[model samples]
Target: MEEIKLNEVEPYVWEINKEGDMLVPGRVYGDKDIIQHLLDDVKQGKEWNALKQIKNVACLPGIQKASLAMSDVHPGYGFCIGGVGAFDVNEGVISVAGVGFDVNCGVRTMSTPFTKDEILKVQEQLADSLYNTVPAGVGSTGDIRLDKDEIDEVLLRGAKFSMERGYGTKGDLDFIEENGFISGADPEAVSDVAKRRQFKQIGTLGAGNHYLEVQYVDKVYDEAAAKAYGLSEGQVLVSIHCGSRALGHQIGTDYLKTLEAASKKYNIPIRERELVCAPFSSEEGQKYFSAVNAGINCAFANRQAIAHLARKAFTSVLGGSGDDIKTFYEIGHNNAKLEKHDVNGELKKLIVHRKGSTRAFGPGRDEVPEQYRAVGQPVLVGGTMGTHSFILHGTEKGMRDTFGSAIHGAGRAMSRKGALSCCRGNDVLRELRDKGILVRGHSIKGIAEEAPKAYKPVEEVVDVMHNTGIAKKVVSVLPLISIKG
Candidate 1:
């Protein structure tokens, strides 16, 4: 590992000046405390070497502007989690590592007409019901087992596949990012092995940081924005957080070898083999992109199925037909999308790769649903278990500064192994129960690994985004019931 140094560029902005084959500067966003933590990690010779990873991303081909890290950034495969980078579509490259193994892994919030009081009274039963209805953990299979042809349809149609099957409403599509169906998803691009791995895993919440929680809006920061998002203080909401399951992992595994070979063929210099990629216009790049896009749809459909199951669970526990649970919005944090953005005051097509980062398109953009166009895109920020999550909206400052992006979560402060060493799963469960929060999990090991102390304080991360004007906070949600895989 190489030593990386940072210089304060501005408030909440730190820069790693271009050096040693770097194509652009690397920038990270965070308050003094968070920034110091990153520096401290580097000093301690820790593996979450975010600064070095950021510098590595800056060295990639055709990278535009800079390699950007959001407030929640922590080192990941190639680009750090919360990493953001865009490149010229014709000249740039696409890496499966950039989009991450869990493609389109994201968060979706569904607000209900019920209040906190209504939910807490049955929190125990609700937790059990959710756990029973939704499949979770490693190798957990869901009720909806798709055949080969139906799986192909799911790969092509995404949430619409579930919607037509009576899983969700047609109106729910508009509230999802890319209308819950990203285009250019070709089933043929995905390998049969990847397809086989995905056959029985449609709605499962595969383990390691994936979960579904029931929460309530405990604080309203921006009244107008909260109103626009159909949120109010004391309102109950359920957040589904998972992704493409085995489908994405298999796609990444299958393409990494191809990209590594393509990198050599294209004569693209590699500072880190983890960042393997080919020119976006190259055949290898197009194939992987199409395959990854299909994986994104698979994730959308997976979440849709989970959402349907959640509705059923809520109906069984709380009374109403689940119609009262309204989709606030669904957005992916891991993805690469082709879009047109202003470059040097001129519109240019670019492929924006955001790994562990959420798209935060601002007001007036057609990408934002018409109902929310005035406020901007809703950004869902999930917190650690027993912590408070947040609802934020996009801002123009974020669009100009970070290609319309924001951090996805309170990034890991400790690895799962490290967390397990210090925390006991049974103890964590007891503590959360003491805090008036109910939790259910497949195993104690899973619970210990996701201990609340294993993450940076989410409030601090959310504050940095809010203060920096990347995303404006609307409300804070306190967990009542948590179901982890």
Candidate 2:
């Protein structure tokens, strides 16, 4: 690998201008140092480069404007992590690789009345309680088991389905993105294999970068936004970060095979084998879209159920009904949405794919919940177990430039295998304990794979989004306890 040349098109915007095989230009949002670090990876001969993935996405059919990479960009299958691409609804293609295996893998943060001191005092007990309550790791199953009819209902109704089982409140839906459900989800489109995988997997925090964390609002950068979001200094927050579990993986796998053949039948050329897709209007594409919508709903329901478990764990440990533990916001990263966006001075319908990216709708967007419409959509950027996470508000600039999107997490700086080789799980656990962060995981290997050093500096990643006016920082949350899978 050599230096991958990029033109600094503007402040905080780097571009790999359109060339051979690219239908659109590739753009990445980050500062000089962040951009340079990405370029240096080429110099170091890193096999995977985010910029290359962005360029590959640009080569896909019907890509509109540009292939965009958010501030927390990192290489992943097909599209880079933190990649955002909007395709023309009529002409563009829908690809499974655009939405990773873990469809709608996302995060939700809730505020608690308890202060940091209060949670810290019983952190160990709370950790044990949460670990015992929430099922985790690969093949982890939970108490919530559903019949075929019930599973279909969960696929269609999302969090509301879980709430019907006495897991959450109707009020919680108000704070969830898309009101905790996406319309047009078709259970029939979801394969029988996928449904079988999900029957007993609901409410489980399946592994690799998935966890339920207890954090405290350590800092507030925007007083007004923080207040509107119900945050205060030293306030404890619970963040449930997981997804549709094995169900999403099975759905992605099932669809990939269908789309692979559909791509050929539809005469869509493939640049990368992983980028198999069908035109949006095609029958295969419509079915995949509907199935993916169901997968997204499954994730919403999954998180809703897990939130209920966390609340119960809190109630048992702290001795209260725990109404004060209210939902801050729920948003997904791995998804593709059909939306109407202003493109080239005309509002056109598009399917925007955000793989490891978040929707950051700005102030006044009707899609934003009424309570926060005056501010903007809340974006949750999760950090590694040993780092600080952040809350940010969407910006008008993001809507104007990147189709209202921002990065979703601290992008991995190293592979899990690399982290495991260098960091011992017991040593990592000890380090977190020394810092007063209690952690419980199914295995020491899981802890080692998620060691903090596996990711980039979280502040630097968030700074690019904040500085570039994509998402404005509201507050920072530091982990006090983490229950991992």
Candidate 3:
């Protein structure tokens, strides 16, 4: 790999000016070293390299601002990981690449009143309890079984369905993004095949990068924000990271062929196969968008049910009531959401696609919960099992630039195949055990594929978020136990 050129527009910002068919310039957020690493990938002639994907996204119609990505940017199916592209509502296209196969794959963090010391005392028991309680791994099924009609209810109502089903309390909805379920989700828009896949899968944690973890706050960076968000040093937190499971994947798979034909029907240019899309107002687009909303609701319900399981695990192990644990925040990463943002001087509704990016709306936004509106929306960043995860807040600059988006995780430094060759499951398990982190998984290969060394340093990734004024750090948390799928 050799060095490639890019124009530095500002400190920590680089731009590939619009050319040929590009509708907007390509912008990236990273320091010189990080940018150089991306450039090296582009120089290597990798087909899906970050720079190429960013450029390809720029070529798409209706894109607003610039085709943007965070410092953790890396090659993805179409857009790079850490990508953000906001498009005009009327002229925009809703794409499957923008929302990965998992569909609303997200993180939900819960805070407990108990301190880390208390959790540490019962760590082993809690680990065992959660491991046995929450079903995980490939094709994992859970206690909640629903028929086809019931599956439609979950798709339509999301977390509300969970609360009504006694999976959680009603108050849990307030802390979730979009109040726990996206409205305008028509279950009819979702294919019957997709609904069938989710009958018994709701609440199960699917394999590959999905996890349920026990973590404790290790440090606080912003005292006021931390206080407002109800965090203190050594406080224990639980993070559930998964998505809509098989249903979402099937939606993406089913839509790809639908949109691929529609793209040609609509005479839309295609730079990448995963970039298949239909105009937002087109019949096909509206249906796909509605289906995506259903997928989003499925994920919300999935997390809500898992959160309930986590609360039960704590109550059973620690002799406490379920009310002791409260939801911190719940937000998705892979999504194409219709949101109003200031474009130039006027506010306009745009469909914002954040792939491997979390929405971090800054202070004063009505979308932010009233309790934390003065600070910002809570942004959950998931680190690898062996590293420290971070809690961050949205910044005004992020709203202005990256569509209120931030990195979702440390971008993969190696592929799963690459990692497996060098890291053994037992060896990785021994390493995490040495650090006093307990891990339980249904598959050893799953553990080996997600070894910490296979990912970039978490601190380095979050440093870019903090330095670029995208998402400010609130606190850092260390893992006590992780239940991996």
Model 1: lDDT of residue 173:
88
lDDT of 3 by residue, 324-439 (tens): 79999999999999999998988999999999999999999999999989999999999999999999999899899888899898888889999999999999999998998999
lDDT of each: 0.90, 0.90, 0.91
Question: Which 10-residue window of candidate 3 scores lowest in summed lDDT?
Answer: 1-10
Q: Residue 155 in model 2: shift from native, Å?
A: 0.8
Instruction: Name the regions of candidate 1 deviating beyond 4 angstroms.
Output: 46-48
With a 3 Å backbone cut-off (N, CA, C), the pairs that clash in candidate 1 are none
Tell me the TM-score of model 3.
0.98
TM-score-better candidate, 1 vs 2: 1
Worst 10 residues of 2 by lDDT: 1-10
Better of 1 and 3 by lDDT: 3
* lDDT value, candidate 3, whole model: 0.91
Report the number of clashing residue pairs per model.
0, 0, 0
Cα lDDT tens digits, model 2, 1-485, are 44467898888899998988889999998878778878887778877778878888998889999999998888788788889989998899888888989999999888889999998789889999999999999878989998888899989999999988988855889899989999999999998888988999889999889999999999999999988888899999999999988889988888888989997898877656667888988999999999989999999999999999999999999988877789989999999999888899999999999999999999999999888888899999999898999999999999999999998998887788899999999999999999989899998998999999998989998998998899999999999999999
Give lDDT: candidate 2, residue 421.
96
